[model samples]
Target: MGLFGPSEQEIETAVNAALDKRASIENPSVPLSSQNVLSFLGLDATSSAGERVTIESALGVPAIWAAVNFLSGTLASLPLHLYKRGKSGRERDTSALGVILHDAANDETSSFAWRKYIFDQVFTGGRGVTFIERSAGKKVINLWPLNPDCLTIKRIDGRKVYQYKDGKRTVTYEASEVIDIPFMLKRDMLSHYSPILSNREAIGLAQAVTKYGAKFFEGGGVPPFAIEGPFQSPGGMQRAADDMDTAVRKASKEKRLALSLPAGHKIHQLGVDPEKSQLVELQRFIIEQVARIYSLPPIFLQDLTRGTYSNTEQQDLHLVKHTLRRWLTQFEQELNLKLFGRASARQYVEANVDGLLRGDFKTRMEGYARAIQTAQMTPDEARDMENRPAKGGEADMLHIQGATVPLGSQPIRGIGDNGGPPLNDEGNNSNAA
Candidate 1:
């Protein structure tokens, strides 16, 4: 029992404190906050959390919101399963690590809730942190996600520790207890560069241009008015100019269709051509630029300027293979390393990208038909892929069109009905003239 209390929790805490004191004294706390992290690191203070490229700022930009939403939403939609190595090469879903990852809900949050949160943070901040709470025998029972920005990684001597800063107090965690997933490695291999930070200048340009457009439309894109009337004295001319300016502004504010001018004064029209301004084309180019920053196809960003029927499918393939593939691979590797121990080679995580790869109904059906006819899979398996319940009797059997015993059982038949070898490129058979 602890000196201060008879409770087990208090006793445990006291014992941990003694042990920690004996090992290595805790370092003096260095205060941190989401707003000052960048400043602490000698970076531009304007780039700190809630300042530049923040979740709010990101969502405020339509292009950024669409890119991040598409990426994170797609990840959260996949069903993660816990799998184990069975006899031979077959696998089954029953591992403890898999169970923890497949549904990471604790007493506080649901699987979907934390999964979406994790992906959103990972893509935005290029990092995600989850603290592990283990039961007896070191079995993980609950995991809690922490704000990536508030959490900092620091190495002391040879050991690494994680610090979660809340105001002036920082709580420390050993590296082994926190699952830190980095989107991509930086120079030191411990930190990552945020995508939003790298693209801040471009995003700022887009925002500036948008604001300019808004103000331009507010004035109806009209230019300042000019006058050609004469006044006798300098003061008289100034007063006349002021009177004319006030009258024009009041007329515009009241939305009057007509304005009165003196007999000698004439209204000069200031003209602007929308085409010469290149506003539409400039906006289109900027949207395309934003899409390229995230490696997203222009179509995904709703920029369909260059879209064509012939190239649409190709673009889809490009996104799946080049863009999504890279992100998914990183996620899978991190999951495999953290959830399943590094030593467990055969048991690893994989995403079913077939959802993105699925073609039109006819094409998909034809491909499945080929698989079934070649004994690659049963008809029930094909149906199961389309989320249809398997028929208990007929669909279980594998069949081929060759009138054979089992698939590939009979030798490939001769080329033709002549019961002879096939003709060569020279149009002559070896056995016949």
Candidate 2:
């Protein structure tokens, strides 16, 4: 009654009465579509637009319990993970990890942020907040809370307002029905945001791995910065190294290979136990797969698996696509944005030779081998080909001169001029010598 103008008990009575009335109207003994059943309760079609409301309502008690448990358990676990990831600094006053944990006791937004750290990547618009508004021709789902539970659908027409010929306009606004279900909410919210987050994460991870490979192993730079004295403390460094070696060997032997450069260099690599590496890789893989699901620009995956056990490539890609798609359906119908379009975009690009040049060197080599075989050229014949000469002579032979634009004037082009073409379309004739 405070905000809704009825006591909780009164609302419950009304809701129950509406449900009974609806059941009788439809068919008391038959199973009905949840929407049809909900409609009998006076929660009509307009309220159910862009939503799967009835299912949540049917599972109301379970949904609430699930939310409560999530809020209590998973939400509580993030700080520990963050701390382990070094969100808190090393060398704190105590060895106890929980001492530095950040707690958001009373803040819902902060709690939401923690939820985002977990599920937002897998959902639409990072936990969708939307509302339905009717214009003349279509429904406008206005952006609202990033996470919305109570949405009011309003209907109005241009006729309700003055046509520049009437005085005061009559507007019809109502809270038609409630869409307070968890799964539908989760679905709608996850769809728009998950693909974006997943795809972005995947692409970013790929880029990072690509860069890591290029910078450290391929380019001969220092390996990642490690904790300084952990290796020197009595038997500590040796144990860590041995553990890393053991982990690598097991991964190699079990065919559980993770990302690595040639000659046993790791990309986004950590030399820890297989379990720890898996955890780290899982974190990285999840991030990358989500990014790829969202359609980020082309990210090159270097064959860091280079001559080892089973390829982690397929496993990694499979997880990414599966997770991304699971969350993609949630926001797609509501937002109408296709998050899985990037693979198609990539396929379109691969139809040309440009794809080969931009592809991994192994692909290029295979292509070259295929070309050589198809041409039936002997190694000696292929080796005898000469480099083609350029049609235009070298610039050094032409005595070409270059210049810069004056401070206040636009640049000009053509013989003797340093600047680009003059402003006039008359072909640089406007410039005074």
Candidate 3:
């Protein structure tokens, strides 16, 4: 031991001992692993609704599929651009890194595909991870996605590291080398809460309702019924019941409107119909639940039960403001941090959500006109946003409405004929006064 402090060997031993102690405390017997093999296999504990709500099962629900697919596709379709901060202002970075973000992450995968895949994992598996492959000079070469199921995250020496199991070999990556986005993080910070797992009851109920409806319809929309007959022996009663079932099925198959039954046998409907069970209403409610889980408005999930012209428009705004903005910001920050590092003050990534308004021609035109008249953006800039070629010259200069002058800076008199004098409201020269 040194006089000033503990020896380096002692510190190493202490750190190792602390890690071991933490492991033992966290998992006394077997080590608690984050491997998602069971989840990948669509195996999870049965939900309250008596349905297995694994990621796959939850996705089998139409509402969940719509929610996840809509969000992932919408985010992926947005244009991501890399920008560099300069003395003048921020300008779009047109370097290879920018291309990697805007166009393609690698030679084989497009930016859209990569982003969609990442968010798909986030929504379903609860975490999305991508590795930034860098060249020897620290230049980004390719962005590769890592399967969240096979990846485990740990904090080692006060730094987060990722361990990805690739077949028989395990590869380790530093936090800086990975872009990690979680649907929701747990208290441990290493693990995440899956949407399907957290809200399994709602999703499971949806699945159950769908399955029940399907089975009901598959039986030719026939409700379960009890056949009451005058039978003396139990064997005769069983045979009668089987004959009734077979007759009902044959009648359904032949599209017969009426069925001939045994004498003195009455068919009593035993279960409530789908309408009485409120299956449609229940399915709609489940859709709303899913929308809530993803922070989406019901309109986005194609639920028009309460949609109106004005409210639907408001929901569109809400989707962008409340839903897409959060995800876009999270993804952008993650990309900027992993690709450029925290110390990189000049360059960062951004997703241009203005593309969402592309279909709103009138809105886009009016917004561009307002921006131009307010001197907020030049004509060329607006054109560039629309992917149109710049007209250059005066079009590149910021323009404002000629009548938009300072409050107290109005001219004393308006120019008259030949620019000689001013005209008044009475069509006379104001100089006469």
Candidate 4:
């Protein structure tokens, strides 16, 4: 310790040390040395999830892409609707909410774009974030999807808040103002589960396999000649041998399979084909594993190794029932919570999965026929689903083809009979007559 404050150098060092400590305490940083492992994903040392899975690793790997793409693409293609339930318990399309949610930004982004963004975020990071621009009454007016990685969640004074770091300054948003849809990552109500972080091993193996493949192909093939018997090589001799190897490679690339080797070297084939290495099987097995992790059908990820003619329809059903259904349900519940306040539960959001469940032409027609016959759906309803215009009077009407009559009475045979008499063939007869 120095009297009358420390020396200039000491003061500078102390201040610098203090600042470094304070900076670390204020804003934690991901270290640079922990940046890359496979030249793709980085396992950060300062992550709350205890592991940082890089986007490059997730997107760089094929299996991961197959799963993520299928999810994002499917969600974007589906039609989502907003419905309002009145006091009478009747629900109808709530267009006002629908307009905003469909586009979210109400500008350049499409409804599919909004859904795709949300779907991708949810599946990959297990958290989908959006900033809700609210009216004076706190009703949501505009919505913008925020980068989940940049968001920091907090709970203050029994109220949850989000601190959005943009550039230098931080912006705090109330829980109500931010749509924080988090999947159950670790029972922490705020932070979410990251699929990439959890499935690092599988993804890493995939990366390794992909790299091995690339490396193998990049080398063209194994060296065609192996040095046999006693041989000695000084610097000049080694250089010549390397030149010979380069020449052999050049020849192999030019489709000249025949190679002239030096006297001491004979052509020794080292054959380990992809089939023998079980790479095809490994690729397929990895695909299935990824599918299971995402609760997706292997067929959905373009894995047709196990697909069959009869099981195709069943696979479609499985996709809707198991995979998309769960995701849609989560979306519905999350939208309900975020868009509609928890206090007053009048309106909720729903995705029209019926469109996804529609089978092929014949199957669809049969199902529609049954629905129409059972009075479960009107002719117009069925036709509307098929994108066809209404056919007129009977198309709008609901019919039950029981061929029975009114209570305590029988169905009249013709227009003349009023629950009394049957008409003679082509002739009108009635009790009223």
Candidate 5:
């Protein structure tokens, strides 16, 4: 049958087969690579069960169900461990360290110095498209992304206006109000480079606005720069290019090594960890394979990257590959221990463990299915009526009396003569009921 969806048992059996293969190959002296583990199960490394049309998930949908079941199961086990630790008069500890570095060569600083450093130097700031508008008060104005072609300026008060610029940025100011001049650049220019700018550098290029500030305010002037940095630089534009070069060099060196090395070492040497690489490579392989089958990334990576600045599509893929590789490594280690007679008692420990240890995916899936089926059925008497129907022509009609009807029941009508019930002929309307 097509592998789009497989029965729970079928999924279980396939997973069991993969586990058996893992036991066999790992049981011997030979170590297993991530690639080897995939090959043994005839699995494409990149795809999830959801994507692949062929090659069923050996672990099955129930297994996936079990994985989710264990999600809370695993988390629930944590409190007890913490409690045990608390009894021992010990507690988990965490720490954070930070250092501020000044760009002495820039010769400028400001109150929000740190912001400049982070956005420009660290993030490699570049130009971006933003909208600018005057508030309803007319005294206040805002700068945001500007539409590239239409140049539509949407005010905070929900009014939209079209603005025209003749290759020049226009920063309008009220007669009494003061505002900072905006630096505008083409949208395409921002996309051409990274999106970080250093405050110190921008400050160095900034000119003092003494006349305007002195005229409007009692203060002498706003400083030449109000931001501090390691400023934006043309040199930093090559950051991505430099990163690519380093990656290429690393790859070339790793490829020159022998393939028989331990998988962990191989991955590490390539500047990646066995437990946390992206699945892009694996996915590519799977696409080349049977052109189907998909898998989720590991739990830890998903947890780490969820809803954060560090989270990205690339990061997600990295975590998936990393976790899968790590699992494969662990499997290989277990097998080696078995072969060497080092872990005789612990052999098959993973498989032997109950749902509490392995995962509770199956229980949850069945529970969910039951819940869904129940939800689809009508409640109370409606459900009962659907299960039972009276005899005769009326039985075909699902609706009875004034109520609507029930599931699985057909509709019917009673008529006289030809296609109707036998009509009474004793002075009763023969053709009418």
Candidate 6:
């Protein structure tokens, strides 16, 4: 200790401790080192059901797999278009960047495949990152996907950057050079919360239920049981138990209806049966929980227990509005920001969700008819939407229904030349046509 107070080293240590505490308070996420240790010890996010729910294990649950696949595939199947603001209005952009976004992301990856992969990563790993390759003239040429597992994000000089570890070297990219979409961003903004990880307990329970059902059926629909026998020693009791187990398994395998045990031995069921435990109901409930995690209806996960004709139709609209719309908007904005830059207001990217209605031909046709009749869309535009050839001439011109006309322009049949009905002596129509 110093003469009047603590030593310089002690003061420094106290200051460091305070700073560390404040940092922990501000950023509550686990440190990378601690996460590594937890992972190494196989203790990361173990659930009450004793299942370790990682991304792979969570996906092993059929409901979770279906949710991720359905969402990613649906979003990827939508048509993405690039547009440019012009004097007339917004027009489709036919530039190389447009082709890259709408058709192919690179020479080897189609746009749909790339988008699916990106969203798969987002749903599974919490983040999707893609690097933009630019030519000498600063024109974007190709887009390459980066593995989120090997990437680290940090804020340097007030701007976020990505450092990706390649096979042997580390490459750093500016924020503008990469497109990043996170399922959910944390308060720190440097890390993201993975859907699989955030709800590990629920997913783990689902996995546990699936495993339990599989084991139950594997034993020929028999619940686990115990053996009670009149044995003289431990070895004799063990042998008797083993014999009983072999006999039961053999009987099940050979499709025999009966299993014979020794006169002195008896079998006792150890646990409740599947039906008593409500395993089927539990499994269906788990599916609903997973659907909730993805903001999807249970019907989408193939759970029709509560589905009705009216509610199922409403669920379709709910999927598009609540679930798909959020993801589509996020993806579109991310692409526009990364591909066009913040200052470039003229160019943007969009996803055409109208393709979702193509499967319902009646609904699509009705929508097109309304749009054309109201002059919101030309007949040729509606035909093009359906991939049909235009009729040319009048088909390209906007046309409204004949019954819709300017107000106060209808002619009065009985009016005089002065635009009033000729006054009879008693104020009746004169019939002066």
What RMSD, rounded to one decimal, does every model reach? Answer: 11.0, 25.8, 9.0, 8.6, 33.9, 9.4
| Whole-model lDDT per candidate | 0.68, 0.33, 0.83, 0.69, 0.30, 0.83
Candidate order, TM-score descending: 6, 3, 4, 1, 2, 5
Q: Write the per-residue lDDT of candidate 2 for residues 1-433, one digit (tens) a residue.
A: 3232332233344565656765895656544344454445543423211323222231232222232233223322432211122344332222221221233312233433443433432233223332233346542222122233222222234221111111244322222211111223223231122222223323344344443445543322334433233244758756755655555556655666463323433334335433544644654454335334333211222223232334454544443355333332333322222211333221110001132123356664565444444444332332332233333322112221233222223344566656545545656456456
lDDT of 1 at 373: 79
Clashes of each: 0, 31, 0, 0, 47, 0
Candidate 4 residues 199-234, lDDT tens each? Answer: 777766666667667766665665234444334657
lDDT of 3 by residue, 288-403 (tens): 89988999999888899999999998889888998899998899888888887789899989899877755477888998988887888888899998899999877887776655
Question: Which runs in model 2 stand beyond 4 Å of their true positions?
Answer: 1-127, 132-135, 139-145, 149-309, 334-433
Candidate 4 wrongly placed segments (more than 4 Å): 1-32, 36-53, 86-91, 223-231, 234-237, 266-273, 402-433
**lDDT by residue for model 5 over 1-433, one digit each (tens)?**
1233332223334565655665694565434334444444454333322222121222122322233333223322221110112454444222110011111211243212322322222112222132223458531133232223322222325432334242567443221221111122234221122211212221111111112223323322111212122425756435633543455456555554222321222222233331244333442332222111113433321333234644554544553354334433343343233222353432221211122222246754454344334444223323233354435343333342223443344233335335453345463445574
Q: Considering summed lDDT, which 10 consecutive residues are worst modelled in model 3?
A: 31-40
Model 1 worst lDDT window (10 residues): 2-11
Q: Model 3, residue 404: displacement in angstroms?
A: 9.2
**Local lDDT at 381 for model 2:** 30
lDDT of 4: 0.69
Stronger candidate by TM-score (1 vs 5): 1
Instruction: Give candidate 3's total backbone clashes.
Output: 0
Candidate 3 residue spans exceeding 4 A from truth: 1-44, 403-433
lDDT at residue 61 of model 6 (Cα atoms): 94
Q: Kindly list the per-residue Cα lDDT of model 1 for residues 1-433, writing each as its tens digit.
A: 3222222223333444545555654633433233343443334324322245444666676777888888788776676665566676657566665666666557787666766788788767778778888889876688788887677665679787887876789889987677777776666555676777666767666665565577665554545556667667888778876887677667668877576777787767555544566768877877887888778888888877799987888999998889878877776776666655678866766667787777899998999888877777788889988999999565776767555234544444345546555555565764575
Q: Which lDDT tens digits does candidate 6 get at residues 167-225?
A: 78999999999999999987766777889978988998998999998888787777888
